[model samples]
Every structure is written in structure tokens, then in C-alpha cells.
Target: MSTPASTSANQQQTHTPVGLIAFAWTLVGVPLAYGLYNTVKAASALFGG
Candidate 1:
């Protein structure tokens, strides 16, 4: 007796927890931060400072 809308609603993707999302972003962020840090370091060397 379920309508299409009701069936689709039941099949919706589950929500990821806030903590897990943050952790996933951190997993991406760490390497990015390191790359930026190294880039800045290399750029600073060109200025001889």
C-alpha cells in the first residue's frame, strides 16, 4: 500500500554523523595543509628570508 513518495523516502541515503564528516575532512585537510606549508617555505626561500 506504499506510495512511490513514501517508498523513495524510506530508501533515502543515511546521514553521516558530524564527527565522522569532520574526521573525513581532516583526513583530506592534513595533506593539504602540509603541501601549503611546504609551498610557503619554498616561496619564502626565493625572497632570501
Candidate 2:
């Protein structure tokens, strides 16, 4: 009765949806963090602190 090996190959999905989202978030977060850091540094310099 174990004659069908094709069922196991087609039953699973190999795509990861969360991993793709995390990767995208990291790509966008790097530049955003740099912008925030520079903004704070500029403010401090303006006040002569």
C-alpha cells in the first residue's frame, strides 16, 4: 500500500513569509537609525553643547 512517493513531495510549502519581512525591515532600519543619530548630533552642535 506504500506505492505513492509523490504525495510527500507536493504536500509541503518551503516558502517563509516572516523571514522575508524581517529582511526587508532590516534593510529599511539601517538608514532610519543613521538619520536619527545625525539629527541628534546636529541639534547638540547647534546649542553649542
Candidate 3:
């Protein structure tokens, strides 16, 4: 009825488990990226100014 990938995708949605991990990763990634960006900005400000 469904392809393997589709089946897995359906299962993933039905259980809604992996999405939590994905959401957490997104939350963590954004903050981590922002922190790194700000750190670089601070260093540049200190050195270049």
C-alpha cells in the first residue's frame, strides 16, 4: 500500500516521537548558532574597534 519511506513517515507522524527530538534540535540549533554569531561579533568588535 505504502512505500517504505512513506510508511515510515506515517509511523513517525502517528507516534509523534521523532518530531519532539527534531523540535529540540531546532531549538538548540538556533540558540547555538545565535550564540556563536554573537561571540564572533563581540570578538570582532573588541579587535577591530
Index of the highest-TM-score prediction: 1
* 7: Cα error in model 2, Å: 33
**What ranges in model 3 sit over 4 Å off?**
1-16
Q: Supply the TM-score for candidate 3.
A: 0.54
Error in Å for residue 19 of model 1: 1.4
Winning candidate number (lDDT): 1
Name the Cα RMSD for model 3: 6.1
Task: List model 3 lDDT by residue over 1-49, tens digit each.
Answer: 7557656546643456898989999999999999999999999999999
lDDT (C-alpha, whole model) for all candidates = 0.90, 0.89, 0.87
RMSD per candidate (Å) reads 4.8, 9.0, 6.1
Q: Total clashing residue pairs per candidate?
A: 0, 0, 0
Q: Model 3 Cα displacement at 23 (Å)?
A: 0.3
Residues 1-49 of candidate 2 have per-residue lDDT tens digits of 6767668766876777998989999999999999999999999999977
In TM-score terms, candidate 2 sits at: 0.58
With a 3 Å backbone cut-off (N, CA, C), the pairs that clash in candidate 1 are none
TM-score of candidate 1 versus the correct structure, residues matched by position: 0.64
Ranking according to TM-score, highest score first: 1, 2, 3
lDDT of 1 by residue, 1-49 (tens): 7567666657778788999999999999999999999999999998877
Query: TM-score of every model?
Result: 0.64, 0.58, 0.54
